[model samples]
Target: MDRTTHTPTTDQSRPLPHVVVVGGGIAGLAAAARLRGVVGGGARARVTVLEASPRFGGKLMSGEVGGVGVDLGAESVLARRPEAITLAQAVGLADALQPPTTAKASIWTRGALRPMPTGHLMGVPGDLDALAASGVVSPEGLARAAEDATLPRTEVGADVAVGEYVAARLGREIVDRLVEPLLGGVYAGHADAISLAAAVPQLLAIAQRERSVIEGVHAALATAAQNPNPAPVFTGIDGGIGRLPGAVADACRAAGAELRTDTPVASLRRTAESWTVTTEGGEELAADAVVLAVPATVAARLLAELAPGAAAELGGIEYAGMALVTLAYHRAELGPLPGSGFLAPPVDGRAIKASTFSSNKWGWLDKAAPESFVLRTSLGRQAEEAVLDLDDAELVARSRADLREAAGITATPYATAVTRWHAGLPQYPVGHPERVARVESALAALPGLALCGAAYHGVGIPACIADGWRAATAVTAGEVSPDLVSGTK
Candidate 1:
């Protein structure tokens, strides 16, 4: 089924090798745009994107709510990830980027929202005095955390669950009360499943090198403090996260990459020098190289026969479902919200795992007269499947109850938008590094094929762009380097 090369009849001039990018999500689009620019210039290489959905963006979706743009999926990029920033610059949307209005965050505990202690990075504290003064943890809990400097260190491979590692280094209380809930909100995953190396490697690096989580954090913070320039916390676009995908798509079109929507890929098979990609409508596409940029599960099905080993490894990767319920209400309608956001411990039997004061947290978005508030409540986590079983009405009701009890918000929201992401967030399970190594090793055996997505490395928007661009770069270069693609493994 694999053809050495493909030259469509409509195409003029010498038809060069083609690069077919599967899935129209950001990863796919990024790869297509990059490859078209670098390899065929769109006209020569014949880059065609085969998306399985009517629209692009995958998880980066935005829509108007009460005449305001609301992002329904993957939200902001941190300034720390420079790859996304560079991609934005390339797409001509660098000017649209903006930092989070405020870096302030909080935790929902004891039916109240309290500010996260300063100098704390993902539950690892650099300032012990601040941790003690923040009132987030008990005195005994604070003492236990400080004692991490004296506790014996555990040496293990890079593949380990974040929850287990954090608990071992710090304590179970911190893992459950702070790290699990706070970081867990990012993936909507169980701490026990998310890999420490793949998900939060910085922490692992701290433990491995410094021998103490606190000492490592302090050293890192000192390095940051010494830097000539330091970046902010949360990074986003001025308009919204939606601007990123839109800008990327525009750049792809300008680069001569053809984008087709309302199309779904049926299957794929590898040829001697190219791949034959079939669409749901029975049309077949030919390409010299292909990039599978969708979810791991989708990639597994597409590469089942052509790359069975990689497909099997990809299929083994797990994902968690997520639902975002955005509720807007007048400031006076709710008594008062004291924190930017709240992360619920797993012990809390409530359906909501986290909630953010969207409008207040971002100064520019707080345009409502009299200070109207927008709250984004999240439901479902890796270990909490029952939350998703609740019907929409029941889900909203439960969320409202949690907010009312936690933040004293009794007023009904004027606008409510609920989005459910099934198998939305990728979970970097233990031994993920080995699994990725296996998949990438298998992919390397194929000279031109590559796979890119949040399923591999960091799930942030920037990481996906980095993976996509790298894959495209390899195709254009006609050869791929292991270090470039196999970053960790």
Candidate 2:
């Protein structure tokens, strides 16, 4: 029952390193695959992926409902990032990618679904006049946003909450009205708790470097527009995000990396030279290098005995629960699927935070069919935790009511599907970067040990892939990358 797949081009008579990845999620898989590629087919280290669940991908899951595809976990990837796109091409799955169908999105505020302002990057509006014309925010809020140039520069470290920084620079109206909703949609976190440094370093750097957010935004936009071939605005597979995990898994297997499902890890301990891993079934494994690519909480528990200080700090990071409810209805039932989808402001007092017209978000989907429209609605954030507690029937009813008010849908849907994630999304609280730095610095002292996953840098798919690749590079050479170890350029 020894599950090890490795071939060393280096002198086999000499000692060869064995790597054990404690998590079958994408982070672990990416780390394993990248290490093999860098080390070459035969010289690559023996790699084993230990997963607690029956399958890989961690938070990424997809399934077909009534012959229609649905993504139960992460839905899309940002095209501007090089990690995901590069990984896709390297793994032989680049042909499956597609861009976001439209740049426009709807906002449910002040009454009904209205077109969101043009040139608005998340909550930071590029054109004040365009934002004022969108009717999403009040005139007073718009006026205040235009005055961000006068806001004084802040000396806060690279570990402050997004709410504290944005509200101080822009105004409470902007944060509560737009920034909070956008962050909640992405991280399912509270703005008051999410770290600007950890969750959005780009935004923080802009404010810190330029001393004026408006000028920074304009400069960045101009630079982006000048690129000969800019990346896609957004990306998703033709079928769903599930394709990504499958592709990564296939690549790992092709690279001769051992993969096991339904084999949950029981415990892990670090020794002077290597790690001793125990499985739930009492199996034991010894590896020269170890990668813990999972949630901070899971990694904390696994490394409690090895790195006590780091584990203690990691265990403090909190996560939130979320639910996705997809409703299918005839176009006549919901009326014309106007625009993209709508995001609900925190002040709206609604059960759902956002709803996307899935059928319209991608061209790969069959739009010529006379079938019903598919609307994917998300519920449960700090503003409304009770929504996650709702039963299937209740969730469907609540979604229907919200759609009726927001999208002018009156007729009932032909079908409804629901998926729930319990404490799935990690919340990077204020001072998160400093805490992560402490943990990483301590871990650097341990030989051939690397940590990767959404719990550290970012929650996006691209970020997770980049983290895994970085971790693999660090552990393969028995040294930590200065950029990754320091966590800042």
Candidate 3:
């Protein structure tokens, strides 16, 4: 049976150019969707999405626990970015769009759950008063932070690690207690290893021109503060972000694109006029253009024979793995919890990195199960994979222990789930920008070829979507130009 859905009517007499997208992840789906949209609803080209896995969505996935559906992967997207939300709306999820609750988060630092400080950029506090009041750092650490304004001009040559630069400016205490947890939440990598330029470009740009990071943060945030009507920080689907990939795939199918799963491309061979994509099962598909929307390693292996330069660069990209442990408890037993959740700083020597009150953060979850409460804890980090190796029972026990200590929740969960993602998040190391540029340079000569994923730009949903559109545009230009994809401009 054909898995494709809602096939739109197309002229059968005309032979449309074929465009093969390698990957069934969100990025690849976005690419196929954009390609179909640009090709006059598949009238100009036949778009086919091929995936190795049986399922789509990549890290965006949903699972059920205790009679309640929960997000087993990413929960939300940056609402300020137009790409994700726009794509969601474009794919008929406009009515399902929902913002998270207004409840603030806390930082588990200095041996307790402290209020998360405002007036900061990625945990680098701009307002010393706010940082002090929040107690994310000690008095001595706060004193050291003040020295950034008086310190000599620090040079961030080309690029640097976020931890290195921030520690040099403020203090290691801030990096360990504050910055690490925040960056871990996003990148799942160590602050000392993650790239400042690639991970936090705005912070890098500020540190480049300004002498004091503090002053630069103020100047950077001033633009947003000046705006009276600021957008919500994030948005989620009524179900979960996992629904996005299916919706996009449905839209692509409706646009007359072929969607396939469990078929991996083994090699990419370039023909004189087109490309030949050989699958693992030895079946072949010809395409005028190809978008390599898979992870770096898989992409490297597939492109080794065709584009060795790109393969070489992509092979070096590292990825971080993590496990999400979701536990469900009776609402009466779990008791009331403050805030959405708290980020656990590694410096505190905690077993779990962070925990989210899924029932509190997403009002949908609360409304879905008024009598049940659900939450999740993240384990493992870049260069710290031992925790991910733990058994599900052990993982759940550690998470429960942490909850008992921090939030004082001693209730046993009625249901539990453990989702492990090995090599899940791509790490952006120092010189990541240069590495990505080199990859682009290598692919420039290879016409009708494109790359898009968390490896190139960002790990967020919006960035991946933007890169997907960029890949589509790169293959065929002026077709899907939009404000969200202006980065490629």
Candidate 4:
């Protein structure tokens, strides 16, 4: 059940299927859109998306901050992944695709801000000299990290924690100051708990091949440098990355799909030749296939009766809550912004984990607010939910204080906005690969039933889109046995 190894087989002769996608997030929308494309015209598959919330997009949201349009949720997608970019282009967002203006980023640690070390992958330094020159790691820490080459190879059985593995090879300073913040920004989970095999599978594979972690990183970086047409690492829509979901939803609807918001799914049951998906309002919809694309907790609740094993594994997955405090100030108040903003590692004892200079990073935002300096700071992480308890005003104040301490800016913001995401990010802990395998295996028994989202494959937009596409392909290909559809398996 290796997620990387399994591939879905397709059958074009299968009878037209009816797909019911639960949850209206990017994953669900992507599934519906792809399903339509696969089935084509002439009363193929009838696709329906049911969203519990009033809005279709899950974390992709847009709002006005200080009279300027801005993203309140996810703002960018990694351009390296073709899924998101391909989907965007397919949905007519090709003209809107924009790359960040700045690539520089700094790390705030050990009492000062310093440029992030070059030749590193997720904080694992490929060039030791570059890391030492950056001054992010102390002399003692640098010396300890240099010893990695001489030390015996550490055995990584099955899976290992990202921090534990890196710290063992390098030093604790690298884990605390470098890896922690970068990894936190994505998973919102502590490095000591995140699974290296699941979070960074490439690194895990390299670790298994090379004796030295440094050598492994160096080899990977070298390979990346050889790419002829290297694309930008990240990209965003002209308006905002939040616009992606709406565009995808539109495409889904255009393909003859019915989308319903404020309709939470209450239960799921299997019947002869079809599956019954009951809504919270007591309405039932029968479908040939069902895709559970909601949060892991919600999916678990709905699948408990149909797939108890998958439900148990889904229930075990944890999530992290986070809040973003976006503040806008006059350009005159903050003369110039440095880098794209800085990441404050937890070891720095700062309330804010990271800050992105929206005005400096994206040319569109700068042009939209020529007189304003807009930036957003993120707070809270896995097991660090105390900041979420504070009121929006208090959170803004704390964010301002942290910004001032980090970048000597004291001017009061002309406008401020706070967006709270409760249990937004999924945590991938050690042995997550095995957990995913178990979940997939259990679902395999219940044909026409699939799951996809940040909780599975990956948390990035591209990964989610790929997950959705795969699920749609699997369900529509008549891969599900008729016996399973009739609850006989």
Candidate 5:
């Protein structure tokens, strides 16, 4: 069926199924889009997305600085994962998708900016020689990392923290210098606590197979190298990844999905006939099915009365806040910086967790503002809320100070912007996968219900889109199925 023109089914005896998506973020929008694709218009079901915020695109936001378009939140989506890419194409972004101009990055460790080492999976170097050449890991650290080959098999029983497991095999240096920074860049959480099973399951699988992680990494890398077809690891729209949410929302609307912003869902009541979502404005919308795509805390509150067990599971999930200090300097003052950006290991005690040289990373951003150079530095991580609490000027000052130390970038930016995300990124501590499973299991009792977000599954664009698809499948299939929400891709 042409979803854009889909009308209600011919059976007048049955009214159209209504799915209320209680969030307008990428996950919610993706869910709406999926529902439309599956049942166009109301042929199968009609979707209504209610967002508490005034705008959509929860974390994937596009903004302007120095008269140039740039991403204020997430910069890119994993193109290798078909969900995000496929959704982008479905929403008419096939031609708009663009890969990064440069993948080269740096790791700021041991008081210097070193080239991000190659032959690695999520910063766990498969080749020690390449790792040593990058100088990211110290000589002593390299020796300890090399010990992984000779070390006895380390048991990764059910699940273990990524840092704890890797450090036990390699040394703490590799975990602190390499893995921590990489994981931090992704989750804004500490590697020592982040779950290997939930965050990097591939690494966990490798740990389980090979007696040594290094050997496992080598085999994985070798297999990847032999593959005839490989996809870009990441992708973004020409304007910025921020354009994705707007485009997705447009597509959902075009498909006859109602997307309402600033419409907060106050409570959800389950009747024998249907699920009734009450808005804070006192408007009650009856939904044949519902997808809880909001934040954990919000979802917990909404599910408190309906599915208390699922709400209890959600209550255990926590979030981390951070700030993005975006700076735009005159091209005359600064030529393209060395690499795309650098990840600052928390061990370095730096104010900024990571930095992205926007102009150098994306061809479109570079071309969009030929006269200006753009870059952004992120600060704060899980339990590091004090840094993000600093005033905007102080945050900018701190970011500049770090840039000066790492990249020798001292020229004051002509334009600057600070974007703060309070309780933004969800932390995936050990046993998070089990927790997600329990949540899903509990939701199985509530018919015509599903939950999805960065909280349960992986926290990325592609993962969120996949979660949305899972929720759509569950609710559309006419059951409360949390089992479908498992797996990232």
Candidate 6:
């Protein structure tokens, strides 16, 4: 349906339901798009998005490094989940989706670069032979991992730490050199603190059903192999993953949704029949529903008056700060880039947590700037914030040192850019699943108010999209109503 802007007038005869989605990130954009589909273009509903930042897209941003387009934040979407792909297709970005050029990655550990073991689920090796051949683990570590099959079943309660469980079954080497880096890449968290149920639910489920962790991994792998046509693990946009938000925002506007950037919401209030959203500039909007698509802290503050319980739960969620240093070097200086890039386990005592050889990993980058080798190195993870305190120049220098030590590159970067994400990634501790459930249940009591974002569910692009879709569905369907009133407000 084609959307057209309608002037707001004091005409009660034709009042249409209004939806105000706070935060113009991917989740808010997706929610606005889904709302348009639900309400259609004629006169079903009016949607307005308020973004605090000057630009939209949230973390999915891009910039030029060495005069070449590169993603400054999130770069890829997990293809296994259909939400992101579906949204992209809906927003006329179907043709722009591209898979990574190379999936091969290595782990820098034990003073050497080692091939990541195959047949593993998040570094939990399913094939002992593969793990042994990769030399990622010492002979003693390999033997310990193999013992999982014959060892007694581990008693896992409602939830367990991914690192604790894996280390008990395998060994510290697996947790340090393998699992830690892989999980760190995703959560920017330590495996010992991340919840098995929240971070790797599938593996957790398998472990619960099987006696051995390795056996569970093997079973999971077997199930995956049975699929005839598995989608590529990840997909990116042709220009950059950053292009996604622009497309989504355009789709929303085209569908008649009003999008305003740099408009931070100050407060939210509920009445007997409608909700009131106040912007920082003191403008008030009356809406039939509201979607709190902001970060945990922002969402908590907004929901405090509406749902104190949910607000408290959201406040408990912790976040990790990180910085990415993007550098461009002459291809001749770093002859023949190695496979995609390498990850550094904290055990390696490296300043950077992971590095992505952007030129080698993405075909578009390679084609865009063949003469320049573009790469990005990530610094700081979880509690490692001291490194992020350094100046941009120092951060770049440290990242360069890490790349040189890990990959044997001595070339000076022709250009460099630093992106810092403070409290960017949310940490899912052992009871994260339960906390999320509690937050959801508490919010369910307050109708017309729904929360969605990376903090509540899976952190991937697809998961956030799915969360947006769900929030849109709930608000549009009237499952959540603006009519409900709690004693708090």
**Candidate 4, residues 379-474: lDDT per residue as tens digits?**
999998878999999999999898888888889999999999999999999998799899999899878888988898899888888778778867
Per-residue lDDT of model 3, residues 1-489, tens digit only: 223333334555645567889998888888887777732233345688999999999999998999999999999999988888878988999999999999889987667899999998999888899999998889999999999989987987778999999999999999999899999999899999988888888888888899999988987888788888998889998888888998988888777889889998888888788988888888888788899999999999987877788899999999999999999999998778998999999988999999999999999989999999999999998889888888999999999999999999999999999999999999999988898899899889888999999888889988898888888878875465445464621
Best by lDDT: 3
Indicate whether candidate 2 or candidate 4 has the larger lDDT.
Answer: 4
Candidate 1 lowest-lDDT run of ten: 480-489
Prediction RMSDs, each to the true structure: 3.7, 2.8, 2.5, 6.3, 3.3, 5.0
Model 6 scores a TM of: 0.94
Where is model 4 more than 4 Å wrong at Cα?
1-15, 38-44, 478-489
Clashes of each: 2, 2, 0, 0, 0, 3
Task: Give each model a TM-score.
Answer: 0.91, 0.93, 0.95, 0.93, 0.95, 0.94
TM-score, model 3 to reference: 0.95
Clashing pairs in 1: 2-271, 18-288
True lDDT of residue 428, candidate 4 = 95
Candidate 2 wrong stretches, greater than 4 Å: 8-10, 14-16, 38-43, 331-334, 367-370, 382-386, 478-489
**lDDT (CA) for every model shown?**
0.74, 0.77, 0.87, 0.86, 0.86, 0.85
Model 5 residue 118 CA deviation (Å) reads 0.6
Those runs of model 3 whose alpha carbons end farther than 4 Å from true positions after fitting are 1-15, 38-44
User: Once model 3 is optimally superposed onto the true structure by TM-score, how far is the C-alpha of residue 155 displaced, in angstroms?
Assistant: 2.2
